[model samples]
Target: MGTVLLAAGVLLWSAAHLFKRLQPAKRAELGDTGRLYATVAIFASILLMVLGYRWADPVWLWPRAGWMIHLNNLLVFVAFYMFAVSGLKTSLARRIRHPQLTGFKAWAVAHLLVAGSVQGVILFGGLLAWAVVSVIVINRANRDWTRPPEAAIWREGVALVAAVFLMLVVGIIHGWVGPWPFGGGA
Candidate 1:
């Protein structure tokens, strides 16, 4: 049942996201209202996926090592930093065309490394494929790309600091929900 819910959630979320890419003309016809509806669907599907994942029985594929945990932690921190960079008006943001997507890919890969269960693979692997496809589609859609204006160094520094703080907060939240990111059992 949990696996079924997870698959349904992934399908729903993917369909909601890909609809725009598949039918830009239709999406444009609906405009902001359509975008809002899609957003709602995506969030709802994600909630379902999370709940399903939590309830699912584990079908482990491999033994997780301490090193894998350390690598996952490092990747997660970098992913958060990339996400922060995406939001800030920084030189890094200007240089990196898809910081958010890159961060998401890293996050998915990190989870995939540690989450050896069948459900975990389905969730993270599915998301990873989605992110990759989204990036490809977006790049193809936008043929000509112009560079953004550069931001101040101070602003970039602040964003980096905020990223570090956010990473710590995320680690704490991870511990609260399940496994502690630092290798300590929750």
Candidate 2:
């Protein structure tokens, strides 16, 4: 049941996100209510995903390796930095058309690297697939993109700092909520 809920949540999330892009006319026809519906669906999907993930039984695929953890840490750092780059609209935004989704893919892959359970694979792999499909769809739909202007150099530093701060906060929260990341038993 938990795995089913998780799968449903992932599917719902993808559907809601892609609806606007895939059916712009239908979305527009619905007017403002479309946005409301989408928001509600997204929230519900998130709730389902959280509950399902926490309650799901594990089916391990592989043994955990020390190197995998280290790699996950590095990739996670890069993922967070990429997210910050997108949010900050730093110079990187000018070059990377979809930094946010790219970062999301990175984050998913980082989790997949350390994930041995069936639930973890489904969650991360489904999200990763969604991100990949979204990128392809978006690129095909809009071939021409107006890149953002070159941002100030200081903005890059701020983004880096933001990434570090976010990583620290997330690490602490993750440790408290789940397994302690550093040398702690899961």
Candidate 3:
């Protein structure tokens, strides 16, 4: 049941995110109401995934090494920084067309490396594929893009602060619900 819910959540997440790109005409027809529906779907998807992961039994396949945890931590931090780059228009923002999606990919890969269970692979790997597909769809829809101007040095500092804050908040939540993330653990 938990695995089923997890799969459902991943499907819902992918479908909801791709609806705009996949069915632009239909999305346009829905107008403002689509935003509301999308918000609900995304929230529900997240909820289902969380609950399913918590309830599901782990079938560990490839066990994570101790050093992988450190690497995961570093990649996770980079992912957060890249996420910030999307909004802050930092250095990499100009080079990367989809900073947010790239960050999502980094996050998924980091989790997959540390995750030993089949369900973990399904969850993170599914998300990774979704992000890749989203990029491809977006590229297909619009081939042209304008590179934004470089942000001021001050914005980099601001972006770093935001990333740190987000990491701290997520770290606290992870510690509360699961294992501690700061120490030598995954």
**Compared with the true structure, what per-residue lDDT tens digits does model 2 show for residues 1-186?**
999999999999999999999999999999999999999999998998888898899989987898888788778888889999998899998999999998899989988988878988889999999999999999999999999999999989998999888888998898998876554565
Candidate 3: misplaced stretches above 4 Å? none
Minimum summed lDDT over a 10-residue window in model 1 is located at 177-186
Which residue segments of model 2 deviate by more than 4 Å? 183-186
Cα-based lDDT at residue 90, candidate 1: 74
Clashing pairs in 2: none
**TM-score, every prediction:** 0.94, 0.95, 0.95
User: TM-score of predicted model 1?
Assistant: 0.94
Query: What TM value does model 3 have?
Result: 0.95
Across 24-135, the per-residue lDDT of candidate 3 in tens digits comes to 9999999999988999999999988888887789989898888888888778887899889898998778899999999899999999988879889879999999999999
Query: Which candidate should be chosen as best, given lDDT against the real structure?
Result: 2
* Residue 130, candidate 2: alpha-carbon lDDT: 93
Root-mean-square deviation of Cα positions for candidate 3 versus the true structure, in angstroms: 1.4
